[model samples]
Target: MISTRLASLLFCSLVLLACSSKPNQDYDTGYDFSQLHTFSGITTASNSDPLSAQRIADAIQSSLLTQGFKQADDTAQFKVNYTFNITDKPKKSGLSIGLGTGNWGSSGGVGIGTSVGVPIGNDSAKLQTIQIDMIDIKTQQLIWRGSDNFSFDTGGEDKAQLTQQTVAKILAQFPPQESLK
Candidate 1:
């Protein structure tokens, strides 16, 4: 019985973790990304989850380094920045718990218990819109921009993995492929 309850909870958690990766990209076609090497972070994000934003920046830096880019303390060849907003969404689900009890009194009594959660004001989920930008150090203007809109249970499992995957997805559109243009 406990196993069944645990399984149900796991399934619900997985359902809540579904992320829709809606990505939108804009960049300066005139600027050549191949000429850029060093990368530094400059952020103006004031979201509730500053740590998530920091994780995102770290993931981005890691991804760029893997692609042969260098990290600079200052005066980088290019700069990276990001902003995020978490919007409260309407509740799509309710919590449920079940309890059962029986008394051995000549087949006398049985009891059942259940609980359901009701959404209060501003007690729904959160949807985050994240935007990542790249700027030329010399030009000091926007050179590339990538944004993604995704939703997941902020308190659920695998948060670090989620952030890493989200950042990786956003950066996959960066450096703007010639075929994409």
Candidate 2:
């Protein structure tokens, strides 16, 4: 029984990991991340909506602050910019039907078979992508970037929670590990 429970737990862990989006991170290897202590984020008007943009901006600030980074004014050392996009994802659910006819095992006997698949649940969904970029104010150049893509059912998800979760996932790797350099 214990082994069965353990196996079930392991399976659940793997499934959750597989479902979560892993951010694609890129950074300037030559830049020293330790010297940067303050940040300000720019949320473009192009973000899906004003409320979502605010949620993302707030999430980024909260994450940075939790990481011991301070928010600054226009003179901040590094500035953050993000873009959020949501588009209608094509429906992958539909009806499938198949029919087959052939001679049966019996002599001169005819056989027929048919199968139909009717998909259920909501077919409308959206694909969302959030891209975060960190730029050096002095050089006006990108120093770090992370982005991830995820999808959600159009009707069920809480937009704020989803935005927070997505932003956190992307920024969790900020200030790229030194060992990676």
Candidate 3:
């Protein structure tokens, strides 16, 4: 029975891990995260498409507001900002060749092998990196940063949805944990 319970727990753990994405995050240990409560509009966004930039900013604003943060332009505690970059992933060769020579039982043998990797999904997808930053307005220093990458297609019909999801995913790590301070 214990073995069965352990197996069940392991299955559940793997399922949870597969469903969640952990963003790359960093923060300044000297900053007190608990005191942060207000933010202004996105200080700056680097994106070729103004519409997409606006969508990202709005998504960030909505996420922060939902997390109990208020918008304060003049007396803001931290400034919210983000950047978007799209990079073409280098094409990968699907075929691989290998050769090996071995001696066993005082006999030598030569072996050659080749393997092909057939992509089951789109291999030409471009990756976009979205980085969100929380900067101290007075010090002009970055206190926290979170970044993540997702497959992006310029002409995709779900650009708005993808932009919002990417921003939310990256900003989900904002404010840092009090333990980090």
TM-score of each: 0.65, 0.71, 0.70
**lDDT per prediction?**
0.73, 0.77, 0.77
lDDT of 2 by residue, 18-87 (tens): 8676889999999998888998766564754777678778888888899898888665899988888888
Off by over 4 Å in 2: 1-16, 91-121, 155-157, 179-181
Better of 2 and 3 by TM-score: 2
Global local distance difference test of model 1: 0.73
lDDT over C-alpha atoms for residue 94 of model 2: 48
Q: Write one digit per residue (lDDT tens) for candidate 3, span 65-140.
A: 9889999998999998888777887445578765555567966665668898776566666777778889988898
- Candidate 3 Cα deviation (angstroms), residue 115: 13
Clash number by candidate, in order? 0, 0, 0
TM-score of 2: 0.71
Clashes of 1: 0
What is the Cα-based lDDT of residue 181 in candidate 2? 57
User: Model 1: residues >4 Å from true position, as ranges?
Assistant: 1-20, 91-123, 179-181
lDDT of 1 by residue, 38-155 (tens): 8876565575687777777777888788878888858588888888877777785565654443446554343446677776655667677778899888888999899876666664
